[model samples]
Target: MQRIRLDAAAAANAEDAEVWRWFSGLLEERRVRWRYMFSRWVVNVDRVHVATEQNFYDAIRMAKEAATRRGLGLSTIGCSRIR
Candidate 1:
């Protein structure tokens, strides 16, 4: 029910700045925070990563890698920009 800033890394780089937008919400369990987001819709269901690393950089990297592994590539233009 609340929004929070969990990333403190500098956003000097364009990619770093873009990382913020891909993030949607936080899911917590056992006092731990996890990044949550909706993947590009595919088939009847979208494949999502619910337990990605909590750190922004790590989360982004993991997402990119996972997408690549699944044959769902994320392009430069696909990166989200912070509002």
Candidate 2:
């Protein structure tokens, strides 16, 4: 699995007020290893979202599994693949 990383301090200066990130590693059912760690600038809060998935469907599947194990659930799931 290849880990994709983005270093904020190394990024070039930009005038955009908001920065957004979008990621898609598999085009036809493959693995995507993702790692994320979030920290608040002025508050004591941390968040993380990471998973190694075989495809878009697998990502949703894994999330559902995790939720289910914790007695939680999801309302909906969506995809934008043109098949």
Candidate 3:
């Protein structure tokens, strides 16, 4: 049982590391900014941004999707634009 738990933990850590790497690459490639504030994940791309519940991976994914949609000239329904 202990070994099983340890393996699970290791897997989770590996997944987290992978996510962090991807996020870092995204920052370099897209000039994106991110922060955790008010118990939420806030991601910004130029004038547009998104805030999501504190799930780190989901928040980043949503932000990326929003940025892509905006870049493609699609509506960003859940994102806000800085004025």
Winning candidate number (TM-score) = 3
Clashing pairs in 3: none
Could you tell me how far off, in angstroms, the CA of residue 35 lies in candidate 1 after the best superposition?
4.7
Error of 3 at 56 (Å): 1.2
User: Model 1 misses residue 50 by how many Å?
Assistant: 6.8
lDDT of each: 0.41, 0.31, 0.67
Q: Which stretches of candidate 1 lie over 4 Å from their true place?
A: 1-47, 74-83
Local accuracy of candidate 1 as per-residue lDDT tens digits, 1-83: 12223232333455655544443211111211333445422211024542255455575556655555765433335457788
Tell me the TM-score of each prediction against the true structure.
Answer: 0.32, 0.26, 0.50
Error at 64, model 2, angstroms? 0.8
Residues forming the 10-long window of minimal summed lDDT in candidate 2: 39-48
Per residue, candidate 2 scores C-alpha lDDT tens digits across 34-60 of 332242111010122333355544444
Instruction: Return the number of clashes found in candidate 1.
Output: 0
Provide the lDDT at 45 for model 3: 62
lDDT of 1 at 13: 56
